[model samples]
Target: MNWLRRMMYGRYGSDQLNVAMLVLSIALLLVSRLLRIRIFYWLSFILLVLCYLRMFSRNITRRHEENQKFLRYWFPMRERWYRMTDNLRDCRTHRHFKCRNCGQKLRVPRGRGKVSITCPRCGNQFLGKT
Candidate 1:
């Protein structure tokens, strides 16, 4: 592992953007293969190249800036994905509701009857059964 560490010593190395690009590339490759689409193949190749280029880049500052920019958009989507998974996992144990005023997400325990939900964001009050 000494050689690998030395090789990456001055490189930007891996980041979330790199991993996301790799996954995107694989997804594109699968779709391209299944659909026999030439455009997706090219897009996947481009993504792979970009991923490698970012990995091997010596400009750490630029890479960090790029990663921060990527995260600005990635984080919200990631949070939503996490929330969806959590909701699915707790489907039997908890109930999720959206605030009618601010659209904020609220969670209450399952099987609670006629619970009054107060929206923390907009201070809206509503009654619902959990």
Candidate 2:
């Protein structure tokens, strides 16, 4: 453990991008094995190698920039995923709706019969039953 810690010192180490790469590589490898695809195997191997390269990189600034770049594109999708999961979890307690004009998502408490929903985005009013 001492040796490992010493080796990791001054390295870029792991971040969300590294973990995503690792997971994607493993998934690709599994799919390749199941489907017997040579291309997927090669792609996964390259991805795994990139993950390790990033993990052991001495260029901390470069690695951090790369991670930030990845996050720029990933954060929005991640937020949507969290929102979807939360909505699913709270399905019994709340009713979710979409605005007709702006397509904005709105949530209301369940069991509110014949309620008027005014979209905050476009100020469009619609009637919904909870």
Candidate 3:
């Protein structure tokens, strides 16, 4: 453990981008094995190598910048994914609707029959069946 710490003392270490790359590499490897695709196997190997290179890099600033750029793209997509999953999980108890006037997403309780929805953003009233 002491030797490992010494080895990584000046390294950039792991960041979100590296972790994501590692996960994607593993997923690609699994897909390659399942589909018997040689290209995916190679791609996964390349990604794995890149992940390790980034982890052991000595340029901390560059690694930080790369992680920031990755986050800028990853956060919004991640939020959308979480929102979709949450909506799926809540499908039994809630209904989701978009306001036609302002396109704001509104959540309404399920089995409410016909209800009037007021958009809080623009105060747009719309009727929908829940």
Candidate 4:
């Protein structure tokens, strides 16, 4: 692996943006194959090429800037996805309610049978059945 290491010595190698691109490319490829769509196939090919180009790019500053910009958009979306998944996972054991006063989300245990919920943010009192 010495030759490979030396070849990548000054390259940007890989980052989250590259990984996301690669994953998107693969997903598109699968979709193209399953649905026989030529446009998706071409888009997947382009994304794969871009991913490789970014990986072996010698311009570190530009690659870093691109990755940072991607991250600025990715993090909040990822957090929302995680929060949604967590809520789905917790649905069996907990219940979620929104405060009518300030639109704050509140979680309560399951089977609580009409309990009073107070919003921590706005101190709004509401009744919810869990």
Candidate 5:
């Protein structure tokens, strides 16, 4: 499939790290079969999914040339960074904290606060001491 190679080879740009990561993941998957490590195999499969997710996720989203250098130069690896933009946006909106017992995400007010919080999910009681 020359079209497939041409399509993959020249879009935005290319990445050695992603290619290396993909290759490493495939190798790990193969090795896990020999080593009988189920976790390694599952993790290798997950990494492969992440590699593909990194590759084609941009087709569904918008891209900017100025703000994202990699998105301009090599778009395939931009998904993780693109996903982080939501977290960065949330970080701009309010304060984020973790629960002590269950590590739940708690978003409090953006400013200094003397507030008591109970995590609804974990029922952990803690003060918002930020």
Candidate 6:
């Protein structure tokens, strides 16, 4: 059991959203089984495997194409996973700033907007409005 945990621990990206995908994939597989949906099992299982591979896989274009072809067969569920992975792979970069005093990074999604933040660690204020 401990070995299984250790093995799977770093199998995917360590983030809230990525962990959510792993959990949701498991739930989807189980639900598909309970509902006696044969295609659902395959779709969910494939999505689960791809989701794990994403942790190490690069060149998202191939994955996106594969997922797109898979989505043609299963529209609803597969589409969601496809879009989710797509969004993760293709995210817009925003202006990011950090406080030198406290080293707290702040993400401003306004695309180079005027923003200011104070360092919570040292209470040092600066004009971060980039």
Candidates 4 and 6 compared by TM-score, better number: 4
The weakest ten consecutive residues by lDDT in model 3 span: 86-95
lDDT of each residue in 1-130, candidate 6, tens digit only: 8976766563433333345567777787888879987877877777677666765555556555655565565567767899988766544654556778678876555455665666666777776554
Write the residue-wise lDDT of candidate 4 on 1-130 in tens digits: 9999999989999999999999999999999999999999999999999999998999999999999999999999999999999878899899989999999989888986999999999999988888
Q: Which has the greatest TM-score?
A: 4
Q: Write model 3 residue lDDT over 33-66, tens digit each, in one string.
A: 9999999999999999999999999999999999
| Residue 67 of model 5, lDDT score | 25
Candidate 4: list runs displaced more than 4 Å.
96-108, 111-130
How does candidate 3 fare on TM-score? 0.74
lDDT of 1 by residue, 1-130 (tens): 9999999999999999999999999999999999999999999999999999999999999999999999999999999999999868898898889998889999899897998999999999999899
Flag the better candidate by TM-score, 3 or 4.
Answer: 4
By TM-score, is 2 or 5 better? 2
lDDT value for model 2: 0.95
> lDDT for every model?
0.95, 0.95, 0.96, 0.94, 0.70, 0.64
What is the overall TM-score of model 1 with all chains considered together? Answer: 0.66
Q: For candidate 2, write residues 9-123 as lDDT tens digits.
A: 9999999999999999999999999999999999999999999999999999999999999999999999999999987889989899999898999999999799999999889
How badly does each model clash, as a count of residue pairs? 0, 0, 0, 1, 0, 1
After superposition, candidate 2 runs with Cα above 4 Å error: 86-130
TM agreement with the true structure for every prediction: 0.66, 0.68, 0.74, 0.75, 0.37, 0.33
lDDT of 6: 0.64
Which 10-residue window in model 1 sums to the lowest lDDT?
86-95
